[model samples]
Target: MTEPGDPRFGATHRRFVIPTVISRATIGGSTCQIVVGVLSSGSATQRSQRGELRAELLRIALRGQGLADPCTVGVEHDANGAPALSSPHIGSVSFSYDGIWAVVAISPSEGRIGVDIQMPRRVSPTVLRRFAPDLATRADDKSTYSEFARRWAAREAASKAAGTGLRGELLRTVLPVARAGRDFGATYTVLDGWTFPALSLAHKD
Candidate 1:
């Protein structure tokens, strides 16, 4: 695995997975890559419950590029509401979906990686009211739910990244919006931005 301070993710470091195909990109440039062949492609429930194992496997493969072990993810809901990985080398990796996508990300440095898989769908005020009662107060812009999602995703990712459950860190918990100048929600505000590669696989059944 690549060391935390390797600078592989820096701007000077190439992003082969995004600009070039993973096959063509150098191994180091693709520490993160999407896994294909999903067992279920259209349902978050299937992806979350079933594809999780496959997703981690792909994550391992991505880590292998950096010479790190992708390792296995253990499912244990903590009081904080984030999923936890049993391995230390795995860094902070989290799994999630938007009823349409299965996604994951790893933080090679902060051990605070977070990613969210979201499907493009219409949002209702009621759903927002249930998850985020403070929506009307945050921003009146068009992407209010998206903002909520970002916050929710970040909460989930951060908690999971720290191996803490999401039970304690819900929206109402009132934790800081960011850490070290990095907005832990929606994206990695710490390093200016964060990109997580997702892998999807299908079940033979």
Candidate 2:
């Protein structure tokens, strides 16, 4: 678990093999930074409060980046259901929560961005077959539940960035690359003492 200000925080693992913490990415020459935070007590018990912590963290991130006060920032869903920031300089804000942890990604430039964080758990074969058949095919002999969760996290994160949110065929979507034994290009990692698959994307037009 690394603190927000630690040197290693907000670094990108871009090797396409392993997960990263507080990771970052570049799109169209602009950089997007992701900040990870623990879920709030209210968020843990109340389903409605799930996004509160992430949103607040986003506000903090924005402010630190020299944006307006978090209270003044607006988070609204697009026609496609992707989250966007109201501020002009800060292009987009995306968040993901998995009951235990929350992550917020902010694009410093004009690119769109999204993020997702998921706690690794046992995934049943049936669920895998429905959501990710490819993973199902190889998971048994070559992959573990953790790997499945990591790949799922990548898909979810990419979906969020695309502003589609699993509306399309999971297999047809852009599958995030994860090397068999190394980390690269949007892999997952741990942050703030939480072991989870965290992903971020910064896309340019």
Candidate 3:
């Protein structure tokens, strides 16, 4: 397995592809970059089509991992509005999307895996204040958006790796990651009998 700081996942696999409206897409190595996309239908922002796309994407991604046959992936909503996979066969996976950029991951019994990706968005003082309230104060910095996207992806990836959504399951759980760097995980919120590895996924395309 590649170490967290391994140069492979960062400097290579600069670009990737995802099916039209897939649950997510991940294409990056240990030292490369990852790309993700979501498929949706209807006028709703979080279209249900994304759920379908995510499932298919999951199967495709896990095909070589030995857990693709009985593949059964679907979107499930938790109390905190966090999305999770509904499959007993899936040990762990990550899901993230930023309109044009989306990504997800499937974990194997003997390897580290997690991914996240987001697209760039228009920023303004008032809009950023409400839309991305978390980073409103840091809008002046050019890397603020990237930082927000990375942190969001990191938290979601870490949570997915832990198999728990926001709803207090990730309560008191905080992920440490670079606002604009690769290999975001070195440690995670360790639980009683669960410990998560530091997985990384970032993109710009």
Candidate 4:
């Protein structure tokens, strides 16, 4: 595993392929990698296939991090359904999927990480208020769907990193601006002409 302050610790690398590795960046004290890919329409609803794809994406991420036999690494989930490295323990991980896109994020075990991706869609005021009331109050008639998705992604990512999975009052408590740089990061990107709102959050150990 790479140490916290190693010169290569925070460096990011990228690749464009069927399962594209969007980008990697330093989050908190760990280097976090994000991978994005498309799932066949037929298998999108197959739980087993989705699981396999997530694992494959993880292996690809580990390989990119210079792991010798990434395929040997095991994956297990916690009680909250959060994924983690089960064997040859190397780092923390998170997963998100929307429509046909599957995204996986991995970071050194030093810190907890969470990631989320949302496809473009209309976010009604009621829905927005339920998820992020403060944001709703601040949002005007001009707020775009992408903006709503981004905020929602940020909250989801934060909740995942904290291992709380959108339950209780946590969703409303995670403010967009407060966590923007402290432990939050988000972006909107286009892949194959499809717009995706993605974000990640890291909680330092």
Model number with the top TM-score: 4
lDDT of 2 by residue, 1-205 (tens): 2334443323222221112235455444555566666543444766545555555566656755666556788887778777777766667777777765667777776655556666667767777776566666665653456656566666666556555567546555434445211122222222233334543343434
RMSD of each: 10.5, 8.0, 10.4, 7.2
* Per-residue C-alpha lDDT of model 4 across residues 1-205, encoded as one tens digit per residue: 1122212222222121143545666656566766766676577777777777777778767876778888778878878787788763587888888776788778776567777787657666777677556556655554456666666666777667776677667645544643254432322122222235544444435
Candidate 3 residue 160 C-alpha distance from true site, Å: 3.6
lDDT of each: 0.38, 0.55, 0.42, 0.62
lDDT of 3 by residue, 68-142 (tens): 464555656667554445763444445665554445555432223445554444457675564456677878776
lDDT tens digits, residues 25-114, model 1?
111122433221222333335534445434443454355446454444454445656544565454444455544344444433333444
Question: What's the lDDT for residue 56 in model 1?
Answer: 44
Candidate 1 global TM-score: 0.46
Better of 1 and 3 by TM-score: 3
Q: Model 2 — TM-score against the truth?
A: 0.68
Assess candidate 1 and give its lDDT. Answer: 0.38
50, model 2: CA deviation in Å? 3.6
| Highest-lDDT candidate | 4
What ranges in model 1 sit over 4 Å off?
A: 1-53, 56-64, 68-92, 109-112, 119-142, 169-171, 174-205
Tell me the deviation in Å of residue 189 in model 1: 2.9
RMSD to native, candidate 2: 8.0
Clashing pairs in 4: none
